[model samples]
Target: MRMPLLCIVSAVLCLSAASGFAQGESPPAPAPSAAEAQSAKQPVFNQEQLDQMLAPIALYPDALLAQVLMAATYPGEVAEAVTWSKANPKAQGDDAVKQVAKQPWDPSVQALVAFPQVLVVLGQDPVWVQRLGDAFLAQPDDVMGAVQRLRQQAKAAGNLQSNQYQNVTVQAAPASTASSAPASTIIIQPADPQVVYVPTYNPTTSYGTWAYPASPPVYYPPSPLYYAGTALMAGLAFGTGVAIVNSLWGDCDWGRNDIDIDVNRYNNINVNNRIGNNQNTWQHNAVHRDGVPYRDNRSRQQYGRQLDGASQRAAFRGDDAQRAQARDRARASMDKAGIERPATSNRQARDQVREAQANRPRATDRQPQARSNRDNPQARQTLQNRPNNSAGRARDNAFEGVRSPARTTALADRGRTSQTLAQRPNASRAAGHAISRPSAPMRRGGGGGRR
Candidate 1:
């Protein structure tokens, strides 16, 4: 008995030792923390992706391109401006910026209204807009560098050049005491300061040969109707001239890899004291971002902190009350300035005007009537005796297929009576059948007898 007990105890100890060894060899991993998981999921765009995003607009004139880069950072406002542009198609150039002065959009976005075609293109791919904006906000230097690289390729290919529409200039970096000289800068400016022409180009062909096979550049062509009669020769095209004086206030500060604002032009356009008197460099306004969530952790930490609770709520909920007030204020301002509010806003007034015009007989109508009377006196005499004429009988029978108001009312009344009879609790089966069945003439002819 003692030997059997010893063997069993020895086996139990051996099994316990194996279980401890197994646990020591492999332990379950702890679940990832929230921050760690989020960081892992956050998308990070590389140099190739940045190049792809910047390719389409990289060749734009310096000022316009700078404003575009700035406006892109506010995707939400860009979307709103797009909708506004579509609704108010006639509103463009300096006047348009002034008309929308009271609008609750970023100054950068407001400046884009002068180029409605650009907004139309931007609005086409909202996903691309958001991604580009996020990329710009996350990596300003990389984005600017990508633009420079693309411009160099285009310049080398002879596609980008000084033309009637735009002036392309290359500025060599000043000689440095250091071992390496700084790189040359490519600057594109509107040939005429007062008139700016937005350039449209095929990115794939314009940039000599695209380097990135994995990520091809996105090309958004301007609407043919928008740029009608403008020839696309040598992979570049220009839309109609947009006469803008002070709407464009930002310029590309390529050396610093950022946008610089012309304080005088900025002040002239952005009334209401939005910016400081001496502030020259363009800074991203978080308030105008309108609650668009920053894609990267860095941008979120940088700009997201500036938003208040109300602004955040407005971003999600559409800010209905605030928008109404803004519209009212805008209308008042436009009225004061003698700038007509967009036809979309005054739809009711337009309808009223149309109705009045339709009701009031015009001189043209009387002229047609008199001309007809002179040409066909017999018809005029026949009209005078229309009650007795065969034509009058035909005219009376013209509406024979349409039920008159009295007839329609009688039919409706009959329907209601049948419904009332059907609803009665004590109605007999025979009465219900009479109410449900159609008259003999109305019923379709079928079997003569029941089986």
Candidate 2:
């Protein structure tokens, strides 16, 4: 009994030692939390990136620039506007905006048709447009600040100044309680209130020595067609003047980091998007976003909820219901007229059709009658007795009084010189005329003569 007890104790001790050894290795790290994973995926643009993105359009007229920033938020609409602009290249200025008033694009996007050149530049680089829009949506203040910085740099470099196309005004930033306002505000406006000219410039050179070497400014020049007959100098080139009456209605409110609407101009151009007298500040309209996803979690949380499945379906439900009603009415009319029609949704009707088809005799399934049928002697004799002059009869009927010439006639001879004098009465005269007529000059080259 003592020996057995000692052996059991030894086995227990060995098992305990093995278990402790197994527990000694380090455990795997805990999985990242959902928030951490999302943060890792989201992109946060820095000041340099914002500057790079806004460089191309930073110097645009205040009202046009404001509309562009507002439009950028709806990248999908921007793309549609690009396509529309390309399709209707001749459409521009206030007239163009009025023409697209019925379009489903955002008011800002519709207004952009006034300057096809701007849309051309925006469409050239889709990725840039998307990123610019994302940056604007995520950090409005940062984007506005970046624009100011670029404008300041251009002004300091003497590249940006008052010209025939636009008037540049620089004033000390108003003493405001809000810290978002800049030290100085630069406002650019069209020289003529009615005619707005889009400026074309190389962002890199116009802004002087670019500070961010890692993220250089993107410079997309407008097509020469936009600036035809207009002199293009070194610094900034103004394209053909776009005569706009009220297409441009939004103005950059630098102090508030938002856009302010000219209610009168807005109403005039956007008959459909007119706002109340009190509603002067421009707000982002998610309905015009058209289901485009936001880049970051913040924007997604803010505007993404505005468009739900129910609302999206509601957009088409009215038209669908109307169509369904029309179809029902048409079917009723046909039924009253004693016309038979298949029920679109009835499986039984389809099955009946298939059954009828299956019951009908098929040509392939019918056995052909044997060539030596004993009972068809009379029918065979009738077929044999039928005359084989059917073609001749048809020809005689077609040409009642006209007789066909004999096959052995001189007219049927292949040889040009094988006819007697009577048959070839005019043949010698025709030959003399052919000999006298000039033959076409022979083509020299082996290749098929000029097409």
Candidate 3:
């Protein structure tokens, strides 16, 4: 029995030794308390969080932060980063900005996330954000998915997507970046966007060209002294033409005034004389230095054509048409000859001629008187008969001649005194008395002589 018991005891002790070796191979640590676990999970920070976290590692720089803020991908983060960078000026131009850009970001929730501000403030190097965006695009399943998950986690930790928080957040944030898509989103208040106005030059059709007032035409008179040469030529032509036509045709027979004086005589004399005078004048004018035809030549040719046409028309038609054509020919001829008649003067001359012609006795009345002279033989016999007494006729002529001057003088003296008396004041009373008292001396002489 003792030997069996010994074997069992020995087996038990071996088992115990093996169990002790297995249990004591590793020492057991004490379990953590709740307060200690909580303290370990949370991090402590002050207002200078960015500097305290990123400055020591040289992971962010002021310039890179400013550039990232300027990029404005996540306006809230960008604005925050700018404030942080401005406070920590020493955190500028650090080349380690690349490493910070590689960190993960959560746009949906406010939590620790990758921000490009430090990278921008450090160098304004586009390579930092580009590198980050490339990485995210390349491994979207990993980095982007992680960020989404972290966003949800942050939401659970009191970072809710609420309107109240978003309104305040957007108000605090800057304008978004010019990128195709914004990198971060926080619930933001709808603010009226700043209006950027661009000025443009617009042309109006209403205002066209500007115009100025025109000056009126000035008038000048021909001076007797200055235009002596022209005046002399004109006078000579006119006088010569008038004298030649009048002396050749007495009292204007055969239409001398109508056809010859107005047409052949005036034109031939005036134009020939004027051309002779002005032939050398055109030589000094630049307008005629090339030996062009004179201006007067063109004018005269035009007038001649008009006159010829009018004359042809008149010859084909009758008297009425002839008169009208003659008048028109005269006007056109005057224009060609550079003759200008004042409207008033021409009218007066025409009126005077019309009055004289109107006042003359009609041919119809004069014809009968002329016929009476031819027919009346008795009237001729009476006129021719009897004044044969020479002494008697001479005595009668002497008596008439003697009585004529005395009678004329007495009548003249009487008329002057009577006119003066009639014009005087109270002359009517004096006239009455003189009429009643009648020439006393003459009356007494007449009565005594008769007695």
Q: Which structure among the candidates has the greatest TM-score?
A: 2
Which residue runs does candidate 2 get wrong by more than 4 Å? 1-43, 177-182, 232-234, 306-451
Ranking the candidates on TM-score from highest down gives 2, 1, 3
State residue 276's C-alpha deviation in candidate 3, in Å: 85
Question: lDDT for model 2, on a 0 to 1 scale?
Answer: 0.83
| Candidate 1: tens digits of C-alpha lDDT, residues 323-385 | 879989999999999986666547877886888799999898799888888679797887787
lDDT of 3 at 62: 18
Model 2 vs truth, CA RMSD: 21.8
Alpha-carbon runs more than 4 Å astray in model 3: 1-131, 140-143, 163-451
TM-score of 1: 0.57
TM-score of decoy 3: 0.14
* Candidate 1 wrongly placed segments (more than 4 Å): 1-43, 174-182, 306-451
lDDT of 3 by residue, 39-138 (tens): 6543232212312112211111111222222232233343344445445433322121222233222111011112212222323433333333222222
Pairs that collide in candidate 2 are none
